[model samples]
Target: MAEQKEDTQRERFKAFSHVFDEGTLRAIHKESSIGSFEALQSPIKIGKEANVFTAVKGDELRCVKVYRIAANFKKMYEYMASDPRYTGLKRNKMSIIYTWAIKEYRNLLRAREAGVKVPKPIHVFKNVLVMEFIGNKEPAPQLNNSSPSNPEKFCETLISNVRTLYQKAKLVHADLSAFNILNHNERPVIIDLSHAVDLRYPNANQMLERDIRIMCEYFKKMGVKKDYKEEVERIIAK
Candidate 1:
């Protein structure tokens, strides 16, 4: 039975091997060996840079994000190079990808410490990141797909999270939008923190303003009133 199970697992990995490189496969196997997850189930989201999948860890579910080796690393380096944390980073493609994964892990930890709602990071190795699954039976829908029942309250709570993320965490989510936020149990859960950067980044304020503007405009369509500039000021206020 154990041999059969191993064969099945190997086949499962083989199925997805076409999408990942040998190094990524080894990393995933390493994660499995460490009991991070038993097996990867199905892909949840496929973005330009990373692919997210649902994985089974013991009895509960977890999320596994794999950064694509063939992704636009040049664009990633361009974005990451500005962050103070990665100031002297080299131009190596694989290094940038690995660093990007590490950045997201750190960002999630910082945001959680700041009391912001996000997926709890489990572990990060190479280009693989395991995190808590934010959902009931299935994964939660994005804010754009599932509008909150109470738009005003939800908007307020989301803004508060953003404020805490900026003030307490001292980070700016460079790419914030309804598409990357999950509407979990009428609450907002921010995701895609790979682009979030330290406040010292040259374009942090600009990115923060853009984030607030996008969120405010999204909530406005749902009848939530908010001035983007005032919101930005409130977030940055001491």
Candidate 2:
């Protein structure tokens, strides 16, 4: 039984390695030992610096975001350096990528606890971050592609989520927009939190305004009347 289990794990690792690097394979194996997931099913997204995969844990589905070890991380290093939470982090490529994953995992946990609609983080090992998959059998589409049945309600819900993400999570996404928000059954699920920063970050206010501006620009095209200043106040209101 032990040999059989070992063989299965080896096969799983081998299959995963076809697309991932040795370091990423090692990271995923470490996470699997903690039961983060049984096997990686398939790649669901190919983002700028990371790839998202669907994994199975028993009968449940989970998301595994793996930062591309070879990705150009200079932008990330600069952005991450500004976040007070990541002060003193090494500026090396690998260190920056791993820290980005860690940041996303921590941000997701904080957002979830604060009642923002976000994927619940499951585990973090090296550059791999696992979280509860936010979708039905297949993953949800971005708001840009998945137009809601009721645009007004969708806009309202999105604003509420942003407000919660700010006032409760005490963080700014710094990159929030229709592109990063999944439209799951008309509800919004915010993703791509690696760039989020605590409000105490020196650029937090600017980041918040930028996020709101992006959202407003996207939603305005959808015919939602928006007052940028009013919306910003609404999100930060006491």
Candidate 3:
């Protein structure tokens, strides 16, 4: 029975391998062999640059965000080059994308240590990141897709998360907005940390302001009466 199951899993992996490059397929297989995840279950999200898939690790569900090597490499390079941490980063397309993935895993680890409500970082190999799945059975919907019943409370909690991320984590979520946030059981779970940067980054303040502006605009539509500029200042003010 175990041999039969192994053969079945290999067949499934072979089918899934078609979706990625040969190198990526080898990396996935390597991760699976090392017990990171058993198999790819289904795609949860198909973002512009990365594909988010649900995978199985033992009995638990895991999220795997795979950066597309064949996608818009120029855009990915532009974004990554500006970050201070990657100052001496190579101009190579695949290397930059891999660095971006590794950066996100590191950022999430920092956020988790800071008490932020982000998915737990499990493992990252090359351009693929394995993380704790946000929801049970199904991946949690983005905040924009599934608005919380209590907009005010939700917004407050989200801002609090931002505060924790800033004060405690000493990092800014540069791409924060309704789309990157998940509304799980009425609580906020931040996702998509690729754009997050440390406070020391040269463009950190500008990215922080943009993130605040986006959240403010989103909450304004949801009827949260507050000044965006003031909120941004409040979060950054020591």
Clash totals for all models, in order?
0, 0, 0
Per-residue CA lDDT of candidate 3, range 2-96, in tens?
Answer: 78877777887787776888888877777777888999899887777888899988789998888888778677678777777778988888888
lDDT of 2: 0.88
Write model 1 residue lDDT over 46-79, tens digit each, in one string.
Answer: 8778999999987999999999888898988999
Which is the winner by lDDT between candidate 1 and candidate 2? 1
Candidates in order have lDDT scores of 0.92, 0.88, 0.87
Worst window of 10 by summed lDDT in candidate 1 = 2-11
Runs in model 3 deviating more than 4 A are 1-6
Task: Report the Cα lDDT for candidate 1.
Answer: 0.92
Native-structure RMSD, model 1: 1.4
Sorted on TM-score, best first, the list reads 1, 2, 3
How many steric overlaps does candidate 2 have? 0
RMSD of each: 1.4, 1.3, 1.6
Q: Point to the candidate with the largest lDDT.
A: 1
The lDDT, on a scale of 0 to 1, for candidate 3 is 0.87
